[model samples]
Target: MEYNLEVAELEKKYSNFHLKHINIKLPKGKIIGLVGENGSGKTTTIKSILNLIKYDKGNIKIFGKNTNNLTKIDREKIGVVLDDSFFAPILNVNDINKLMKKFYHNWNEKYYFEKVKKFNIPTNKPLKEFSSGMKMKIKVLCALAHEPKLLILDEPTNGLDPIFRYEIVDLFADFVSNKENSILMTTHITSDLEHLVDEVIFILQGNIILDIAKNKIDNEYGIIEILPENISKIKKEDYLKCLKYKNIYYILVDSRLEFQKKYPKLEIRKPTLEEIMLILVKGE
Candidate 1:
């Protein structure tokens, strides 16, 4: 299969943290959401793919070429926006615009200025004076201005309000409308992504524990609420994981069909991404 980006057996280690055997693929024309808690190695994974830090060992490829040998053409096809702006703090938006035109061969002047206006960033003020959200918007603006084939974003919506967040997410939807474009974004805002992503990859403490299509969760994954007496009716083998409360059991089932077959009369509800994350991380 043709993939926009791929990582295999990726390993990275620090004093107190380790990312082991990380493997994931971003296909052409698809948006994949990377969801995890604060210290789950999301940023580390992204950095590793971009070769920003030295990974212990692994294979990372973009557009069919190994990242180790990424050409200038390959680099040009990818846009990246991280939590912190990489631009010089002393430069204003206009100054950076003039400078970036010399940097990217395909920089779109109209699109760049349009994004600045759309984001309401101060044209003359230094980047250091912009708010966190404003800085983030400017960073995204720069990334998108070059019309890259792939976008790698880390925590893109963390500080923005609802309106800007929704607008940016919608812009992402439009970007991937072309089959050649794709995105791999890590975000804590699961709600914003529930309807936007094609695939959801859940990473926890550096390991990828869940990888599934967004639609499959609604049809295949489910949660069952049962009283203690009925717990045995739903076989232990049927549920992926579960937790018990005062007088009830909250069970997470891998197959809703199996869950329904076991408890035809019981209630099973659609579990949200957040709930699944919670159950996986906090449940027994």
Candidate 2:
């Protein structure tokens, strides 16, 4: 099997916080969503893959080769939008175009110009003068101009208007349409990714809680509601987690068949990703 990126037992410690052993495999040509609460090591994982942060254990591979062995050509194939302030405040979008052209041999000027125009970003204005959403658009255009095979985005959706955020997410869908390009986007906007993400990787407190396809999650996990009468009779282990809101109980179960066997009269409903994450983090 071929993978675009893989991290096995990668560990990083910063003062009091520690990113425990992380094992992740990103297959080629897929959009994988990295979902987590604030300060959950999403950026740390992205940095580990890019070799921006030092790790104490295990190995990280890009394109099947260890990150330590990554060549210049390998670096050229991976693009990154790490943060909102990567570019100098004085540099404008036009200035960035000139800068990126020199950095990547495969840079496409036409593509860069087109994206800038499509996003309606003012090229001559200083980056600091532009709004947060405009700056993010410029960063994304810079990454995409070089025709990179993989995009590692760290919280690219932060502080953007709803319209632009949706546009940016749609742009990601267009990015992976070639089937040769892949994206590992770390974001808190799970609703924006509802239909766009191919795989969802849930990270909590530096540990991966779930790694599976979006369709599988929608089809497999369910929110089961048992009436006051049937709640006591239901097997506790069969339900993975549960919550109590007001006077009703909202239960999570992995398999509907198993849940139904025990509580045939119970009503089960499809749970959203946000709902699942809430139940995982906050128990009944």
Candidate 3:
């Protein structure tokens, strides 16, 4: 019932893009995955929540305090891993630690060093010398060094290998086990989310189209494959969305059990997060 982050009627407008009436409620100890296409305003919504940009309307609360009013201490409780934001390329791992120590009161030097060693990141090489995956690891480690209560990450696993991605995901699982911490992350990798997130939010063209528990998607939602010619056989209320490609039609239904009972001959299979997003975004 308690939420770590809440957004109501959030709106932002640009010359060519608009984020409209965005609302999100991230409860304590839960991981929420945000998914959308490349230009779907994911970054814009995050920036708005962090008060990094001006919004035309809406209220954002982090730890029950307005984002606009968060003091330095309040901000310290949140960790952020933005895709394009980090230390200067010239800073090495040691230099980054030294710099961050001066910025955060709770910076855990021992923990940070331990993770750096575990991740096998080089201490002497500048960030520019690290590979993209290595850079991502350093950013994630830095975000975790301060023991933040809420993590806001933008593609934190973007450049990691499967092995490291699994490790990072495990770390996230451990982080939220306390039930006082939470995470809001946006990733193109829906497969990771399928096993990691407690809930998922789907955004399309700057609008939040779906926000549901991951289990609901796994247990209740289903996809039905049928020939286009048989589409008329399905009642409109039975399916949430439908798409046609080549010779087949893919229909998404929220009540898979009932739908299956209604049309026993129809092929109904559980929907993955990616499949659900595809249908919601492109299906009619």
Candidate 4:
């Protein structure tokens, strides 16, 4: 399968923090969710890929071209949306549209304004006066107007209302429908991507702890609730991770189908994205 983005042996260090050998693959036509705590290397890894920051080692390739060698066309095909945009605070939405049009060869001026109007964004006011939600909407409008082949987003829906959130998710699904586009996003709201994401990459304390396919997440892994005493009967190898709450123990099992055969008395159910993160992050 062709990959939209690839990272290998990526490394960076700071006085108190280090991101080591971070490797990632974003397959074309899929949405890959980057999951981790606030201080984890999600942003750091993304920054290194975008060359927004200098990395000590490794390489990033977007559209099969090394980031360092990205041509104007290649760069233009990749869209980026960050939580806090670096656009001049004095610039209004109209100014932003004009500026981006100069750089984006595929910029659709009509589509851009249509999106702005659809989202009910004010066109005349300076960006500095807009709320966080409004700012993010403008970023989305810009990213989608150019019809980018790949989207790299950081909390693109951070402050959007539920209706807009659903709209954005559906838009992502539609973008990849052409089977030539993909998305890599880091978000605190895992539930939003529970149904939309094709892959999940879990980073912890600057290290990638889990990278699992979305289908495997749904059909294989599960939350197993059983008495702590029954835990020993379940093979030690079967436990991916486990946590205790009150009298019940939540076990993240490698395969729910197999576990059910071994312990029919236990209760096994599908785990949400948040529950999986909790067990993997905090459980023993």
Candidate 5:
């Protein structure tokens, strides 16, 4: 399969944290979500992949070229929106447009302004004066104006209201409508990811614990609540994780149908991405 971005055995070390041998493959025309608790290395992994920070070991390839060797022309094909990174606070919409044009060879000035108008972003107001939601929208719009093949975003929908969130989600859907485009993003908002992503990757304490397609998650994974006394009735291999609270056990099983066939008395329900992550990270 052709991948727009590839990371293999990527490792980075810090005094307090370590990102260990992370591997990811983002196929063309799909959106992948990187999710984990705060301080679990989600942002660290992204920074490493983008070469914003140095990795001690491993390879990163974008558009089939090593990230270390990507030329200015190659870099132009990737758009990025970082959580804490953006243009200077003093730059207004027009000032940003002029500056970006000098940086990106394929920058679409007309498209950028059209988005500005459509989103009703203040053309003359400095970025510092904009609301958080407005700032995020402008950043996203700038990323899209370059018409990149791959979009790397960190919390792209962080501060928007429901209405604007829906619009931004729709815009993302349209971006990957072309078979050549792809997106990789990290968001704390699992609900948005539930509707937007093709696959979800769960990282915990610097390790990737799960990587699965959205359909498989929806169709195969399940959650069951049972009394603590019934725990032994469940085969160890049948369940992926188990959480205990008071007198009840919440179990995460990989195959709902098969587990149901085995234990007909226990109730099984579909597991959401957030629920699954909770179980994996906090369960034993």
Candidate 6:
């Protein structure tokens, strides 16, 4: 598989905090969900990859070339959507088009216009007049207008409504449908990405707790809700993680066969990505 971004030993430190040595690869033709709590280094990792922050140690390779060595043209091939817009609040959509056109060698005005129309984003209105969701849509349109081979998104679904979130997720799917384009999206909203992400990369306390194929995780892991009395009968090794919610015991098991054979009294259930993540992150 061709990798779009390779992060090896990526590290950064501040006076009070340190984004410890991190490693992960974003492959082409798939959507990777970079998930973690608010302070789990998700944004820091993204910044390191984009060279927005100075790193102490590590090498990030983008499109087979080190990220530190990427030229202007090479850098333009990757589009990014940060948490906020770079455009002035008073600027209209046309101003953004002109600015980005001058900035990107491969900017497509026609494509941009088509996307704006599809999303019903008003070009005549100033950006400050747009709603949060509309502004997000504009950012997304701008990212894709340049025909980038890789898309890097940070909290792309942060403030959008359910309807628009679904629409944007479909947009991302369309973006990566060509098999040459790839996306690395970091968001706390895991359900919005449930249908889109091909791989899952979980970051916790500056460390990657889980990095695996989405299908493999789903196929191998299950949520077993067992009685509090029967919890002692189940082997700890059969489970990846477990939790207790008031009266119910939520156990996460990788192999159901062993559990089924060992504990017939337990009830096995399919788990959502959010459930798996919550349990893994809880560490109990």
Please give each candidate's TM-score: 0.93, 0.93, 0.96, 0.95, 0.95, 0.95
Using TM-score as the yardstick, the better of models 2 and 6 is: 6
- Give the C-alpha miss distance for residue 117 in model 5, angstroms: 2.0
Where model 5 places Cα greater than 4 Å from the true spot, the runs are 227-233, 245-248
Could you tell which candidate, 1 or 6, scores higher by TM-score?
6
User: What's model 4's overall lDDT?
Assistant: 0.88
Model 1 per-residue lDDT tens digits across residues 1-284? 68999999999999999999888899999999999999998999999998999999889999989998999878988999999647889999999899889989999999989888877889999988988888888888888999999999999887888889999999899999988899999988898788789999999999998999989997889998788887777666878887776677788887888778867888888988887887787677
lDDT of each: 0.88, 0.83, 0.92, 0.88, 0.91, 0.87
What's model 5's lDDT at 56? 95
Q: What lDDT does candidate 1 reach at residue 206?
A: 92
Candidate 1: lDDT over CA atoms?
0.88
Worst 10 residues of 6 by lDDT: 256-265
lDDT for residue 169 in candidate 5, whole number 0-100: 91
Q: Residue pairs in steric clash, candidate 2? A: none
The segments of candidate 4 whose C-alpha lies over 4 angstroms from its true place after superposition are 227-235
Q: Model 1 RMSD to the real structure?
A: 2.0
- Candidate 5 steric clashes: 0
Residue 265 of candidate 3: its Cα lDDT?
A: 90
Clashes (backbone N, CA, C under 3 Å), per candidate, total 0, 0, 0, 0, 0, 0
Cα lDDT of model 3 by residue, 221-263, tens digit: 9998898779999999889999887778999999889998999
- Please list the residue runs of candidate 3 whose C-alpha ends up more than 4 Å from where it truly belongs after superposition: none
lDDT of 2 by residue, 80-165 (tens): 89774487899987788888888899999999888788878888999889887788888888778898998899888777889888
TM-score of 5: 0.95
